[model samples]
Target chain A: DVKVTQSSRYLVKRTGEKVFLECVQDMDHENMFWYRQDPGLGLRLIYFSYDVKMKEKGDIPEGYSVSREKKERFSLILESASTNQTSMYLCASTSGPAEKPQHFGDGTRLSIL
Target chain B: AQTVTQSQPEMSVQEAETVTLSCTYDTSESNYYLFWYKQPPSRQMILVIRQEAYKQQNATENRFSVNFQKAAKSFSLKISDSQLGDTAMYFCAFEGGGSNYKLTFGKGTLLTVNP
Candidate 1:
């Protein structure tokens, strides 16, 4: 089975602080994604990396950035955490295409105070 | 751009009963894929089923079956003999087949199964 692991299951940060969310996949998938899920809105993509050092902005990419320095690790960076940034963060990896099902890590529930 | 819609925001069913979740999408492309993903309380996303636009027959896995209408762009999931473990948030997603592997997901339906 494919395993996608996130660095933290839950996190607490103060406003104006920087935060990092890490994710690693054992399957060496070529595509990795970061999304923030909110209550009325579905999973909106924040950023995605197709290959090492390759990144693309998704529908909602503001105040957030991503890093893919290695094949197995993808990191989401919050430039300046705010109360509004508190939400569940999900990381997913896919071997090739979106047609193939993505394996998601247990999400990180972030709280910014 | 493609959009997925789940008309029902919440649903409930008694254990051992049957329930259906509706999903519809709008896409200009003819070739794409649809999927039903379940996220339980554990917050882990699990793929329940998938359907290709070219195939007419619905996809089924154990107790989960999908009613795929390509022309209507409607793909609904029917869960038979629902169990307590079946309670979760179900999301309907669409993937335009090609180099772009981005998935467009619905707002999701929160389903409850009472014993």
Candidate 2:
């Protein structure tokens, strides 16, 4: 089985603070993704990296950025956390083609007060 | 751009009964893929089933199956002999052939299995 691990499951941050969310996958998948899961809106992609040091913006990438220093690790950075940024964050990794279902980590439920 | 729609916000089924979750999508692309993902409370999300646009036969996994209507752009999941463990938020997703890496997901349907 594939294991995708997120650094934190439950996180609390204050407004205007900078936040970092870490994700590491054991399977060494080539593709890694960061998504924001919210009520009614579902999961919207924040950023995705096809390979190490290569990143592409997804549908919702406004206040977020990503870094992939290693193939197994992907990080999501919130430049300035706000109350509206409070939501569940999901990390997924996939190998080869898009037809293959992505392996997801246990999500991080972030709360910005 | 592709869009997935799960009209039912919430649904319930009795144990050992059958239930269906409706999913509709809109896309101009001829070739694509559809997926159903399950997210259980406090657990990792997993893929429930998948269907390719070209395949005529519905995809089935154990007691879970999909009803795929290509013309109508409909894909519905049917769970036979449902179990309580099936309770979760079911999300219908679409992956276009041109952009296989990205997926468009629906709002999700919350299904509860009762004893």
Candidate 3:
């Protein structure tokens, strides 16, 4: 079985504070993604990395940045958290183009107070 | 550009019943893939079923199946003998099918199964 793990299941941070959400995949998949989920918007991709040290911005990447320093780790950074940034963050990894389904982490619920 | 749309926001079904969720996608690319992902309260996205655009036959996995309409660009998921555990937000996703594996997801439909 494949596994994707998020560093924190639940987190609370003060507004304007820097926030970091970590994701790790045990399967060593080449592709990793970060998304923020909200009530009506579903899952909006924030950023994605196809390889170590390479990243691409997604549709709603304005308030977020990502880092893929190592093959197993991908991190999402919120430079300054805001109330509007409070949402459930999800991380996913895929092994590349055989049409295999993406494996997802449990998710991090971040609350900006 | 590719886009996925799920018209139904919420749906309900009684135990042992069947329910279908609608999904439609727009893409200029002739070849691609469609998928149905289930996200329960656990907040983990699980692939329920998948259909390749080039395949004429619809895809099925046990009680979960997909009704894929290629020309119409519609893919709908049907859940049979729904159980309480089946209650969750079902998202329809699409991948470009080539080298780009990034998924474009719909707004999702929340399905509730009542006992």
iRMSD value for model 1: 1.1
Residues B5-25, candidate 2, lDDT per residue (tens digit)? 999999999999999999999
TM-score against truth, every candidate = 0.98, 0.98, 0.97
Candidate 3 chain B lDDT trough over 10 residues, lowest sum: B94-103
Candidate 1 Cα misplacement greater than 4 A, ranges: none
Candidate ordering by lDDT (highest first): 1, 2, 3
Cα lDDT of all candidates, in order? 0.94, 0.93, 0.92
Clashing pairs in 1: none
lDDT of 1 by residue, A21-71 (tens): 999999989999999999979899999999999999998899899999999
Checking candidate 3 for backbone clashes, the offending pairs are: none
Best by lDDT: 1
Which is the better candidate, 1 or 3, if ranked by DockQ? 1
- How would the candidate models be sorted by DockQ, starting from the highest? 1, 3, 2
User: What tens digits encode model 3's per-residue C-alpha lDDT throughout B4-35?
Assistant: 99999999999999999999999988888888
Best by DockQ: 1
